[model samples]
Target: MTISANLALAYPEIILAVGALALLVLGAFMPKQTSLVATGGVAVLLAAAVASATQPFGVAFGGGLIADAAATFAKVAIYVASAVAIPLGQPWFERRGVKTFEFPVLILLSALGMGMMASSGDLISLYVGVELSSLALYVLAAMHRDNAKASEAGLKYFVLGALSSGLLLYGASLVYGFAGSTLYADIAKAAGAEANTGLLFGLIFVICGLAFKVSAAPFHMWTPDVYEGAPTPVVAFFAAAPKLAAMMLFARVLADGFTDAVAQWQQVLVALALISVAVGAFGGLVQKNLKRLWAYSSIANIGYAVLGLASGTSEGVQAMLVFMILYMVDVTGFFACLAALSRQGKAMETIDDMAGLVKERRGLALAMTVFSLSALGLPPFSGFWAKYVVFKAAIDAGLWGPAVIGLVGSVVAAFYYLRLIKVMWFDGSAGATDKPPMEAKAIGLTAAVFAFPVVLVAITWLNPLAARAAQALGLA
Candidate 1:
């Protein structure tokens, strides 16, 4: 189809691309100010993305590209989260006297890459799409090059990211060599008892590589260092949007490209899921830094999402989508609470620093409590239902052990989260007296953004989310 003919279904990404370029130019002339000034650009782009989301699904370029519901939801998450993360970082950039223009541009580029990956139908296309996103993030993680922690994060992310990309490329080449095509549709068409063993090996390598991006354990060494070292605001971005993109791509690869190989991958996912949950549950217990604890929490959370993926059914994929959405909300809320805890001109990082926080900021403390509970998958709140949906999918698929273990991991995770809560509310620190002079309205706004889905899941019509997931998976 002609590009113009295909335009409406892709309005969100086109707007993002155009906005990235415009910002590159516009920001150079504009003075450095608060992050909220960039709100206009973010809003325009987010609106475009949301607008495209409700469009009809279609194939473009002979299945080399797709425009569909799954891509739409991914774009929605990316735009909305970017809108939040950008403002949160603005104050840092303005204070440092650095150019903030390129920052939004990079996010736009990353979002574009994510949008492409969401719709890619072939391995070559998917790899290119993923690398585009990764390249942007590598620069973003390092943007604050003078900060030792930021530098370290950039270096670590670059080194590990390169390795993962190499592995993924090699696997893609092997898959292409064996199957003579990289398109997921073609791969699905070709699979059967006579499916080439090389294809299977390539598949394993691809999964291993993708796991690193999502920070699933065994391949997760870089996560804590990167999260702790990068600016807390940057870490917030890392934890939120990119994950939704990676998880969506992972789902596409499994459901669309390799549905025939579900049995092979199901075992692999189960193993990763178990290790992630165990390591996350234990590792988080000893973490002193809030970001690191959340990093470990992210690992365990990915495990729960993976458990849903391993179900290898339409319902399974929908549950995974819900998990990603809910996880995004919980993390964003937690980050907002973190940002809100700055006292004496320092953003709080260590758990001990949070003592008497409830005394200082009652509303933020309550928000943190809600977010912590959500992260632990506790009841009545939105996170509980996120876990419930996934666990139910697992049980339905006869994956009883993973489902039951998932429950145990959730309980184990609660221990550390509660530890932080206790510090905020009960274990008052000796000198925890400082508070931000200015309110973090962007932080609160983002927290509200994150909170909506939680309420949506708890109230009427989860079917909308489920239907979106099914459409994204192209179940029709």
Candidate 2:
């Protein structure tokens, strides 16, 4: 199909791309009016999200892009997560005297990239989307230019991101050579014809590259450093939105392009899940930095989410979607609460900084408790439902070993999460004293509001959404 003919199918992404450019120009001219930029950014994200939900679904750009139910769902989630991050980050930016119009523009562009990634149906477009998102993220990581740690984080991310891109690109080329086309449909057909060693190698490379993007174990070396060094709000954004996008793309690529090679990729995913859970469960036990601890937690969650993907079935995809949604809501709320806590007008970095938090702020304490319990996958919480779905999917797929390993990892990870709760509620340090609360009242309230849906998701509305997503993938 002609590009113009397919344009309507890509309107949501087009809107994001165009809006990002306009916002960039506007920010350049109105550099001091950060609030205006943030408002415009949120508006653009909301509009694009609505567009994604309402737009017609089909192939576009000669089958390079797909506006399917799954893509639309993921885009909406990314948009909402990015919108939430802006306001959550604004207070910290203002306090640090680094609040700028450019920040939100970068977020818009990042969301645009993620949307593109989710919708991509061709190897070329996938690479483009990855670069677009990674470039913006690298810049955002260094937004606090004066902070040495931020600069280091940005540099490390850029270098490693570039390496991953190279690996992905090389794999794409190999696949194209063997499959005789870059389109997923063509690749699937070619891969099904016979077991091609070149194709398997290419798939491995692609999986490795994607694993790096998701911070799955053995490729997660950069996650802790980046999360620790980046600004808290940026870390919050990193923890949720980009992950949803990457995982969406990962699952799509596997299901659409490598369906015939499920046996191979499923094993890879299984290994990744096992190692990630181990690393995540044990890695945080020694970390004092709150953000770094969450980084490890993120790896573990990604491991669990991948369990569904490893099942190589539509129901598996549904389970993965449920996990992603639960993770996004809970992590977003948790980080918001984290960002709300400060010491002497500065954001707290370590778990110790939260000492006596229960005594100081009951609301924040309770919110944190709920989020922590949810993260631990305790009963009646949204997270428990998420885990249950994936584990059931794994068992249904007959991946008993992985399910048991995952459960054990969950148990091990719970210690740190529970420990944090204990410290928050029962423990105190010498530095614990009554200081004026930081400018996080709005953030704390926002976290609380977001937490309710998460707490009641299973009982109320999450199933319908997951069902819709499954229907989108034709799994229902």
Candidate 3:
């Protein structure tokens, strides 16, 4: 491809990268314009989404990056989710009497990196994208630097994230050593021909590293602590966009670069999925803190997505994409509900803290109930469809045993979701929470409506779009 054509193909990333730098400069010069910076950040993200949707599909940067339907699909989700996260943080920080422009800038930069991750065509680009996003997240985790728990969360995330990066890099080196190239197309060619021990060894390590990014067990030790300790809005962001980006990258690496080794990777993914589902379902049963519980919820959810990917079919990829996007909405809405509620000027962090929430904050409670039900994969909700497509894909690919285990895990996980609903509607009042910020309330309610009515209409279009995107992966 010509230089101009490659640059044209990279329009979405260029928008984000340039926009983030500009926002940073604006924030530095106009210190008090935090809200303005946030609004601008959202605008920039939306612009990138447009660019992503319209960009020509092709390999770019000499096969280091790609602009394709799958990349476009993932990038649009990441951009929109990051945009929603910005308004959420502004009110949250304002309530805490902290005003800083850096939050939006960090989010923008993080989204930029996630976009790179989705488009990455080679190991070097993958590492760059992962590190860029991870570094921003490390800073975001401790945005509330004065809070001890926030500081701890940031420190832990940084240390663990670094370790995962090391694993990824080492694996990349091994793949390069064995395959004699870093480009994914080249790696696929090499793996297809020989399927050697060294390549397989490196692939396992690479899976381990990406698994950490999605918070899949037994590498999920950091999720609960980090979610519990970080700002609620930040946790909401964490639970949504980044997970999708990592999983897309994961699917690309496996489906595009290692299709010939499916027999090997499939077993590893199944083991990871089963372990994650078991841990997420059983581990969440005893949690008191809502964030911690949701942390486990996310782990299990990622497992479901991975299950679909393990099927190694285009239908599986489509199913995974659909599930992740729907799950992202549910999780973001759940955390938005959490961020919207408070008790006597303090944030509500526990299941008990939400007792009789329906009595005082009926709208918030209703939205929470909708999200909870949807999360439990109940009928007529988005999450049910999310699980259905995944399980269906698994079964069609002769993964019935794993699918049954996943279904059982869903049943077990329903207990926590039901407990939340019961507490909100039936338990005695914990007293009225502080009036919620309008932005958070709007996001929660909007997501609830989407989870139900909007999703009914959405799935009609979403299914075909996802299938088309999956076809772009060149998967069978």
Candidate number achieving the greatest TM-score relative to the actual structure: 3
Looking at model 2, report the run of 10 residues with the lowest lDDT sum. 430-439
TM-score of 1: 0.94
TM-score of each: 0.94, 0.96, 0.99
TM-score comparison, 2 vs 3, better candidate: 3
For residues 1-476, could you state the per-residue lDDT of candidate 2 as single tens digits?
Answer: 76675988888778888888888888788787788888888898999999998988789877899888889889998998899888777757777888677888889889989998899899989998988999999999999989999999999999999998888898888999999999998898988899999998998899889999999998999999999999878888998999999999898888889888888899999999999999999998888988999999999999999988898888888889889988887788777777777666667767777777888877887887877888899877777888999999999999999999999999999988988888888887425433433545556555655555535745356666665666654221
lDDT of each: 0.79, 0.85, 0.94
Candidate 1 stretches greater than 4 Å from native? 31-37, 96-99, 437-442, 445-459, 471-476
> Better model by lDDT, 2 or 3?
3
lDDT of 1 by residue, 1-476 (tens): 78776776567667877777777666766746324337656776677666756667787766777777777767777778877777777666555556566777787788788888877888977897899989988888888877788888899999999999998888888778877888888776665447678888988898988898899988889999998888766777888888888888898987887878888888999898888999899999999999999999999999999888888888888888888877887887677667656666666889888887778777777778888887887776678888988999899999998899989988988999999888889975546555542435347544644464447644355447555665567332
Model 1 lDDT at residue 398:
100
User: Which candidate number maximizes lDDT?
Assistant: 3
Model 1 RMSD vs true structure: 2.3
RMSD of each: 2.3, 1.9, 0.7
lDDT value for candidate 1?
A: 0.79
**TM-score ranking, high to low:** 3, 2, 1
Candidate 2: residue 45 Cα off by (Å): 0.3
Clashing pairs for model 3 are: none
Steric overlap count per candidate: 1, 0, 0
